[model samples]
Every structure is written in structure tokens, then in C-alpha cells.
Target: MAKSPLFERGMVTRRAVLGDKHVDGATARKTDFDDDFQTLITEGAWGSVWSRPGLPRRERSLLTLALLAALGHEEEFAMHVRATANTGATAEDIKEALLHVAIYAGVPAANAAFRIAKQELAKLQEAAE
Candidate 1:
């Protein structure tokens, strides 16, 4: 099937934010079982919301970190933490967002997110070295 324009836009946006390596790995891992689901997110999340110009990618990165943390999506939160490299969000920005999670979403959630963020950030720093 021909990919839609939205999906094409989403592919560009997703590659911009997540990098080619990660997206390539995801594409490689896709199977018939999850292919549709993958396409959905590529089009929906990356195309519709993330492609919007209303907010900069930096702010969107922070918001996504907060929501993922609050919802206890640890793996996804950590991935976004790493994605900060491409999104222009700093560790300080992530700290502030997690602090809000502590206040509004509860300390426990923020606490776990902090742990994951710290680990991921350290890995990023190490990779940069």
C-alpha cells in the first residue's frame, strides 16, 4: 500500500526526533502483528501532534517526559530522556518537569522517573565522552 502524506511527514518528524538508528531498529523489528500499530503511531503521534508548530520540540519533549513519567511508563520515559539530545531539552529541563510530576502526579512516580532519567542521562554523557 502507498504510504499517506501524513505517514511520510511523520517518518521525517520521527526520524528527526528519535534519530535514524532507533527508527531503523523499530522498522526492522516490525512484523505483521505490530506493523499496523507501528504505522498508527508513526502517523498519529509523530504526524498529528508532534508535527505541529504550535510548540517547539524542546517544550514538547519536556511535556512528553512528564506525561510518561506520571503514567509510570518507565521505558518510554527513559527513551525520551535520551531523546532530549535531538529535541534540545536539557537535563535541567527534565528535572523541572519531573518536579512537577512529583507535585501533581505524586512523589513516587517522580522518584522512579528521576532514577531512570539519571541513568539515561549518565549513559548519554558517557557516550559523548
Candidate 2:
């Protein structure tokens, strides 16, 4: 039997983009109320746009960070910003994005993103060194 397209593609893309440990941890945390939210995001966001080949993963990561920063979605922004370390987007890349956010999305938005990104980047740096 063929695997259902939704489950197979999303699981593959989700694992690829987020890493096994992250996805598995997310899965472990899902409750009945949030399970649908999890599935929707994994199958839609990860399985669809993130799986697209139009951009390199690093470029996509940069774009995701910028949009999240611009929108003031602090929690999601920080999560994606932290994912930058895994995607080879450095702290400098995040700084550049925040600079753009300051110009277009307002200074306070950029300032908050930078503060969060700094903590996240510091964690990555410590993990590396």
C-alpha cells in the first residue's frame, strides 16, 4: 500500500528541517488540544513551503527569521532564530535581518529580536566551543 501523501511528505520534511530530536521532543509534548496545531503546522508549513526547492535552506532560514521578526511573533521568531544555528545561518545573518526589521518593522521590534537572538547565539557558541 502506498503511504498517505500527507503523513509521509510532512514527516520527511519536518524531520529534515527541524531535526529528529526537536521533532521528537515536540511530539512528546503534544496534548489533545495542541495535536491538531502540531499536525497542521508540520504538514502545511514544513511539508509544503519548507520542502520547496526554490531557495537554499540557509536562505529560507534567513527569510523565515526576518518575517517572524517583522511580525512581532516573538516566540516563533526566537524558535526559528535558534534553528539558524542548525541551518548554517550565523548570528551575523540574524543581525542583518534585525537591521532590516528596524528599518521596516520598527526599532523596538528589531531590538527585541536582537536580544533574543543574542541569547540563542550565545548558547550555540558555547555548545560549539
Candidate 3:
């Protein structure tokens, strides 16, 4: 199948935010069943939205984390937390975002997200060591 321009752009933006190793692993694991699903997100989420210049990646990262946490999407929230290192979002920034989640999205959601964030941040710290 011919890759659309949007898919190409999305691949670049996805790599920039998620890192090449992560993206490569996901690509290698792609199956015929999920190939289209993968393409949709690559084009829709990474290409059209993430590639836009309206908001910097740091801010986008924060928004994504908050939304994922509020919706109780634990896995995606953790992934985005890990992606923070590449997004230029500091631990402090994540704290503030989670605090908002606690107030607006409910304490339970925020609490769970906090735990995941802590674990993911620790992993990032250890990786840097």
C-alpha cells in the first residue's frame, strides 16, 4: 500500500516524540490485522495533530497525559509519561497536570495516574543513570 504524505509526516513526528527505538519496536510488532489501525493513529494522532505547530510538543504531551489519566487509560498514560523525556516535559510539569486531574477528573483517577507516573519517571531516571 502506498503511504500517504500524512503517514510519512506522522512517522517523523511519532519518532520525534516517542523515540526511534520505541517506534521501531511497534513497527516490527505490527500485524496484518492491526496494520490499518496502526496507520490510522499514525496519520490521525501523530500526523495531523501532533505535527501541527499550533502547540509545542511539551504542551501537547501534558494535555495527552491529563486526558489519558482522566479516562483511566493506564497503559497509554504510562507510555506518555515515558515519552515526556523526549517531549521536554519535566517531572514538575507532570505533577501540575496530575494535580489538575485530581481536582477536575476526580481524585481516584489522579491517584492511580500518580502511581504510574512515579514508576515511569523512576524508570526514566534509572535509564539516565
Candidate 4:
């Protein structure tokens, strides 16, 4: 089937935010079983929502991190934390977002997110050095 326009837009925005390496890896690992799932998020989340010009990528990054942490999605949270580099979100920004999560979402959730964020941030740091 031909790709939807939203999916196309999402692919471009997703690559811009997540980087080629990550997107390439994900595409490389795509299986028939998960292709539809990937497309759904690409179109719905990345294309339709992220493609909007109102919010800067930096704000979206922080919001994504908070939502992931609040929802206890450790893996995606870590991924978005890594995406901060491309989004212009600093470590300090992440810390503040997680602090809000601690208050609104509960401390335990934020605590786990903090651990994951630290690990991901360290990995990015090491790669830079």
C-alpha cells in the first residue's frame, strides 16, 4: 500500500528528532508483525502531532519525557531522553520535567525514570567524549 501523507511527514519529522541512526536501526529491525504498529505511531504521533509547528521540538521533548515517565514507560522514556540532544533539551530541563513527574505522577515513577534517564544520558555523554 502507498504510504499516507501523514506517515510521510512523520517519517521526516521522526528522523529529524530521533536521528538517522536510531530510525535506521528501527527500520532494519522491523518485522512483518510490527510494521503496522510502527506505521501507526509514525503517522499518528510523529506525523500528525509532532509535525505541528506550534510547539518547538524542545518543548515536545520535555513533554514526551514527562508523559513517558508518568506512564511508566521506561524504555520509551530512555529513548526520548537520548533524543534530547537533537531537540535542544538539556539535562537540566529533563531534571525539572522529572521533578514535575514526581509531584504529579508519583515519586516512584519519577524515581525509575530518573534512573533510566541517567543511564541514557551517560551513554550519550560517553559517546561524545
Candidate 5:
């Protein structure tokens, strides 16, 4: 039923988890030049690891957000922050994770993540209301 054991769920799980716009934007950016890189991440990060069943989706989402935040990946952190809502992690959970990141990853990284999360979360909430 599933194609990729890595992304076995196909783009469905990833899209539902990460949002269509973000995933589509990423897909649209794929190029023959970057085909290898694209395949690597698609099969490795998105398909392989994220597809694993060990951790609950929310826990995986939380860990991903924290890692992205701490590593100073602003856009990625922002995207994952948005994904948290779908993963059963609340906005408050994101706040807590970022606060922890601030303490561990330094203020600048956390500050940027906060701003991004704030903007994205606000957008998501506005859509809901």
C-alpha cells in the first residue's frame, strides 16, 4: 500500500504533518542539479527516520523542532514549529521547547526561532479563527 519504506506513507504523511505549501515549495525548488540532494533528504530524513514507528509523532515533532532551533536553522525551525500543531504539540509546547533552546542554544538562535514561531503561529491561529 505504501511505496517508500522511508516515506512509505508517500507525501501524504509529510504533507499532513508539514503543510502543503511548505512541502510544495520544497518540491518546487527541486532541480536536476540538486536531484541527488533532494533524493537524499526525501529518502533519508523525510522518509527513513521520520517514518519510523518508535516515537510518537508529537515527540518526534518536538525533538525535530528543538534540534532545528538549536542548530540555528531558522526556516526549518519555523516550519517544524508549524508542524507541531498537527503533531499534537500545542503552541505552548513550542514555547516551552524554544525556551529550552534559548537556554541551551544561546539567546540569538532562540530569539530568531521565537520570532519565526510567533509569526507562523499567529498565522495558523488566525486561519483557525
Candidate 6:
């Protein structure tokens, strides 16, 4: 089947935020059973929503990080935290977003997110050195 325009657009956006290596790793591990699900995220989440022009990528990154933190989606939150480098979301922005998560989503969740974010940020910094 021909690839959808949304899928194509999503791949571009996804690679931009998540980086080529991360996206490639996921693609490389994709199985037949996950094909449909992967398409849905690429088209719906990355393409339809993230590709919208209304919000800046930085703002979107903050929102995504906050929501992931609130929901205690540790893994996804960590991934998005790393994505902030490309999304233009600074560490300060993440700190502020997690403060919101603390007030609304509870201290424990925000605390956990802070830990993950710190770890990811350290790894990123280490990579740069």
C-alpha cells in the first residue's frame, strides 16, 4: 500500500523531535503486529496533532512533558525530555512545567519526572562533552 501523506509528514516531524537515531531504533524494532499501531501514532499523534501550526514546537514540548509527567508515563516522559533539545524547550522550561505537574498531578509524580528529566539531561550533556 502507498504511504499516506500524514505518515510521511509525521516521520519528518518525529525524526526532528526524537532524533533520527531514536526513530530509527523504533523503526528497526517494529514488528508486523505493531505496524498498525505505529502508523496510528505517526499519523494521528505526530502528524495530525504535533504538525499543527497553532502551537510552537517548544510550547508543544512543554505541554507534552507536563502531561506525561502528570500521568506518570515515566518512559514516555523521559523520551520527550530528551526531545526537548530539538523542540527548543530549555531545562528551565521543563522545570516550570514540572512545577505545574506537581501542583495538579501531585508531588510524587512531579518528583519522579524531575528525576527522569535530570538523568536524561545529564546523558545529553555528557554526550556533548
User: Model 2 lDDT vs. the true structure?
Assistant: 0.82
True lDDT of residue 117, candidate 6: 96
Angstrom error at residue 100, model 6: 0.6
Question: What's the TM for model 6?
Answer: 0.98
Alpha-carbon local distance difference test for all models: 0.96, 0.82, 0.98, 0.96, 0.81, 0.96
Q: What is candidate 2's lDDT per residue for 79-111, written digit by digit as tens?
A: 887687667788778888789999998999898
1-129: candidate 6 lDDT, tens digit per residue: 987999999999999999999999999999999999999999999999999999999999999999999999999999999998899999999999999999998999999999999999999889879
Clashes of each: 0, 0, 0, 0, 3, 0
Off by over 4 Å in 5: 1-10
Candidate with the greatest lDDT versus the true structure: 3
Which residue window of length 10 is worst by lDDT in model 1? 74-83
Model 4, range 49-115, lDDT digits (tens) per residue?
9999899999999999999999999889989999998999999999999999999999999999999
TM-score of candidate 2 against the unseen true structure: 0.89
C-alpha lDDT of candidate 6 relative to the true structure: 0.96
* Winner by TM-score between candidate 5 and candidate 1: 1
Candidate 3 Cα outliers beyond 4 Å, as residue runs: none
Q: Candidate 3 lDDT (Cα, whole model)?
A: 0.98
Q: After superposition, how far is residue 31 of candidate 4 from its true place, in Å?
A: 1.8
- Candidate 5, residue 90: lDDT: 87
Error of 1 at 45 (Å): 0.2
Candidate 1 lDDT (Cα, whole model)? 0.96
Which prediction has more favorable lDDT, 2 or 4?
A: 4
